[model samples]
Target: MNKEWFNSRAKINYFDKGYLVICAVLSVIEQQSPLNSTYR
Candidate 1:
């Protein structure tokens, strides 16, 4: 697929990696943080 092609051919961007890491960390916090119930 086109996505696979991009993965093989494109240069990785540090900004893109940082964004994904931030998103993953936020998801873990939302799932397990003590403040989760406070928000809901």
Candidate 2:
């Protein structure tokens, strides 16, 4: 209902989406290289 509340909610949602994306990318990388030696 308030401006501050809406802003915080939007920040939380943005961070949550970013975290999910990072996890998905990490999983894909791991699957591609189980040893994780090539990327490093």
Candidate 3:
């Protein structure tokens, strides 16, 4: 039971890190788009 709990927690942490990375990338794209539009 303890092992199963640890595995689930690790999975959650992995997914959370992935989600954070995706969010960071999306935010960078979003920030760049406005600058691009203004320059054009």
Candidate 4:
């Protein structure tokens, strides 16, 4: 019910989305090139 709580929750959601996006990108890269070391 507080302003600060809402702000932090928004930030956390943004961070989680960013993390998932990165994971998806990595998965695609792995699929394209399974021997690539870029993700490692």
Best-to-worst lDDT order: 2, 3, 4, 1
Give me the candidate number with maximum TM-score.
Answer: 2
- Find the 10 residues in a row with the least total lDDT in model 1: 7-16
TM-score against native, each model: 0.53, 0.79, 0.76, 0.74
> What does candidate 2's lDDT look like per residue over 1-40, in tens digits?
5999999999999999999999998888888865566877
- Enumerate clash totals for all models, in the order shown: 0, 0, 0, 0
The residue-by-residue lDDT of candidate 1 on 1-40, one tens digit each, is 9998787655467667888999997787798868666666
For model 4, the stretches where C-alpha displacement exceeds 4 angstroms are: 34-40
Give lDDT tens digits, candidate 4, residues 1-40.
Answer: 6999999999999999999999998778888765557557
User: Which run of 10 residues does model 2 get worst, by summed lDDT?
Assistant: 31-40
Q: Pick the candidate with the highest lDDT.
A: 2
What clash pairs does model 1 have? none
The regions of model 3 sitting more than 4 angstroms off are 34-40
List model 3 lDDT by residue over 1-40, tens digit each.
9999999999999999999999997777678988647655
lDDT of model number 2:
0.88
Each model's lDDT comes to: 0.77, 0.88, 0.87, 0.86
Kindly report which residue pairs in candidate 3 clash with one another: none
Candidate 1 lDDT: 0.77
